[model samples]
Target: MSQKHLTIIDHPLVQHKLTIMRQKDVSTAGFRRLLREISLLLAYEVTRELELTTTRIETPICEMDAPMLEGKKLALISILRAGNGLLDGILEMIPSARVGFVGLYRDPETLQPVQYYNKVPKELDARMTIVVDPMLATGNSLVAAIDLLKQAGAKNLRFLCLLAAPEGVERMRQAHPDVPIFTAALDERLDDHGYIVPGLGDAGDRMFGTK
Candidate 1:
């Protein structure tokens, strides 16, 4: 199901890739590769609304108008660490897109986000910005990341992730209703430890081979 604030990408290829990544036995290399492939698919759905303008072009046989993305190149803000997994694949598709990073770690005890680093592109107000992160479990970190981006003059923004929890989706909706979320799946709920149940474990760990 989809709402104004959230979009679930249920493409068969995406689902198949996600299922493999969920298995505890999947190696770090395998998980990282799958995440990159899935990010390419998710990027399609998330950027569907990009404005386009026709540009005059010459074909071998004739001249014609070709559709091109309008305005300044879009900006992609990776939410650090795990977000880099998704960022890598999307960059392959939009090579000219601007890139930035925001680093925020969740405090295990309080389940809140703590910012540690941030750097974003200039002219955020004039470009469409998309925030990339692998998991949106508690939504605390994602929300905090977006908060910083807005403070930096970003007005148009979107959030993309591999998986999301209902609690996290609602948290984002309540906190930043203007931003839309795109994810491969919306899982059941978050566990007591603030982890998404049936989630693919810690995304950063699975992708980076770290504990």
Candidate 2:
């Protein structure tokens, strides 16, 4: 257990594509496609520290054995609906991993995230969990998602997002300092309306072109 936290990937591939995503002119299809690709790349970064055990596996060519990841019980929890885009890409890479969903919306008056749906794997405690979302603005939903996962006995948790605001990062650090966060880019701040500054706008709407 390491106290060191927070890793904002500054890789050029992530940065360049992240700029394209922020552009207002980017089409919905392009944005959605990019989000998926970005999630795959970002997901790769987030899984770097994944807890893996040494395993022995015989090689096809020789009698030697090597270490391989154990268990297909990883829980990839998506914070719908923007997170669905990310979830798709990650699933492509780790098809055997178990899937979960956490659907939440903000209460206009209280600005609190209300969970409308949550169905996580029963053995959440034994599996490592990855929470995916496109943006982390005020972190209302992210925090709530973490809280819910913790309740489900998910001790090893990692949060992955395409873009994150400073306010969200700070809030998440204060709330979930133990959980590591992986993001494509960290923007300056959140806007007055709680959207990420220079953000692509309501991710669900942008992805689906719905009102």
Candidate 3:
């Protein structure tokens, strides 16, 4: 999956919210609120192709057939702390989605991701799996996370992030072309520190006020 396989959600609302989130002085609560709101919008774009089934139901006016999502429930896998921010908002849109988490922390010296936790719903092969992470900078962690999911039998998968760097996107494309990426913004190069340039700056720290 090259850049062609990536979907940059350039919707006005998404861009506007992302601008606010990128500001240096925004409060933690404000950042969280914007992320949740933007996640709802992104969720709409990503799930546009969901399989639908017709069901007979009674509306306020009369009985009619209604289209509803078909097959197994969707699965949302949040990539640790920052991913949780996007997860909360997406869950609001799909309350029935099964939730999971993959906890990985970057090794300071080597700048590599180390997994500490992994848990996901069963029957992943039967459902669409969306992995959420706020920042896709180095792409190492995202690759590792997807590898774990595939090993667990997840065939259909997607990656969602707020900001993505070219390096990360390319890395993902090479490592897992089968998975399409959905992002709010495709930013400039990653800095030497492995942070996306002009990014919201340490998504987990800003979201949680840890910095």
Per the 3 Å backbone cut-off, how many clashing residue pairs does candidate 1 have?
A: 0
Better of 1 and 2 by TM-score: 1
* Tens-digit per-residue lDDT, 17-115, candidate 3: 999999999999999899999999999988877899999999889999999999999999999999999999999989999999999988867779999
Candidate 1, lDDT over the whole model: 0.94
RMSD of each: 0.7, 2.4, 1.6
lDDT, candidates in the order shown? 0.94, 0.84, 0.93
**Root mean square deviation (Cα) for candidate 1:** 0.7
Runs off by more than 4 Å, candidate 2 = 1-3, 53-60
Whichever of 2 and 3 has more lDDT, that candidate is 3
lDDT of 2 by residue, 154-202 (tens): 9889988888898888899999999888877778897768888877788
Clashing pairs in 2: none
Worst 10 residues of 2 by lDDT: 1-10
Residue 54, candidate 2: alpha-carbon lDDT = 69
Look at candidate 3 and give me any clashing residue pairs. 1-177
TM-score of each: 0.98, 0.92, 0.97
List residue ranges in candidate 3 displaced over 4 A: 1-3
Using lDDT as the measure, the top candidate is 1
